[model samples]
Target: MDTHTAATRYIGPTGMDPIFNRIANWLPKLGIDVAGGRLLAVRGRKSGEWRTTLVNVLTTDDGNRYLVAPRGHTQWVRNLRVAGAGEIRLGRKVEAFTATEVADADKIPVLRAYLDRWGWEVGRFFEGVTQDATDAELADIAPGFPVFRLA
Candidate 1:
């Protein structure tokens, strides 16, 4: 349905500040959600074991929820691609569902909403882009940020 071709250009993840990353993951594991943060667990493609990580969940005006990758094409993105489903957990409360990659051309709105919500925490990964960025700007950065619609 998208007129734009899928974006193939990938930007690898920047090194996260280890202490910050750990605390972020720890809080959610302890059942405290920080500004839309949740623990996402999925089966690893190679290990076939449950892998968990911190993710920010965004629910837009139209009620559609999504998980946007601030860091480009990371391990979870790769695993989800193969697994096709995962769980979004808030502590012991786990919601299992299928995941579909949002086509690059169609990621504009989702990216915008994600930045609007998590920009302060994840703005570094966007390379100067922001929620207020134009459609073209968002489009240009879309491919680097993989998005998933959780159903």
Candidate 2:
């Protein structure tokens, strides 16, 4: 499937994924950004229940806010696609907004910035691409990482 199209893909996590994700989910609840994380909540496409997980929110210099899925088309990513909207929450702060996925061709800047600001935490997920990678390199991996602009 062309992830650049509507069919996004996923990169499975290692065994430690659940452990780290669980710990990450706690930091923001305690008002800590141990991973530059926030709680992302979206309605379940099947159950209509709100589902949440820890995610990284990237804000560029120009004031655009985004959510990048290093783990690729995760459950939240699929739900967000179906829901078309979601919430970003810190301890007590919740910002609900609509989201639009960025096309692979246009994800260079967003991907670079996301890696630039957070590679230390998520670099392994990118198959060795880094913040300093060329645009072509980032574009090659763009389709695999779902990015959303928060409005």
Candidate 3:
């Protein structure tokens, strides 16, 4: 298979593939944070399935934590929304928090931060939307895309 397909296979279902999970589990020790700030565990919106996604952790100037899904329309994003809350595991500490979608204007800085962390591939994904689209508009395009803050 081509590289993209191979990568997709590895990241299958939010990097749940066995090998991917192993690597994901080890990444932090190596000093690379995969999901941005923390690892989140959420239930699937429609299937009632449980999933773990490593998302970028966003912090405001005032210190509140946020998680933004550039592809907000994805299933996991919806799941977090419907479920209203999820668990964030940072190293050995795990905490439960509510998830909220941030406004578009608010999302811009978060998206910028995400781009800074993940770079072009992520930035390009959000760039595809119109310049005028609200953060929510761009966010809505990808149902799984979301900006999650702590409860």
Top TM-score hit: 2
Which sections of candidate 3 miss by over 4 Å?
1-22, 25-37, 47-49, 127-145
The candidates, ranked best first by TM-score, are 2, 1, 3
lDDT-superior candidate, 2 or 3? 2
Please give the ranking of all candidate structures by lDDT, highest first, separated by commas: 2, 1, 3
Put down candidate 1 lDDT per residue, 14-128, tens digits, no spaces.
3666667777888888889788789999999999999988998888888888999887778899999999999998878889989999997899989988888889988977878
* Residues forming the 10-long window of minimal summed lDDT in candidate 2: 1-10
Lowest lDDT 10-residue stretch of candidate 3: 3-12
TM-score of 3: 0.61
The residue ranges of model 2 lying beyond 4 angstroms of the native Cα positions read: 1-8
- How high is the CA lDDT of each candidate model? 0.85, 0.86, 0.60
TM-score of each: 0.89, 0.91, 0.61
Q: Tens digits of per-residue lDDT for model 3 on 9-52?
A: 21223534567656675654344655454577787777777777
TM-score of 1: 0.89
RMSD of 3: 7.7
RMSD of 2: 2.2
lDDT of 1: 0.85
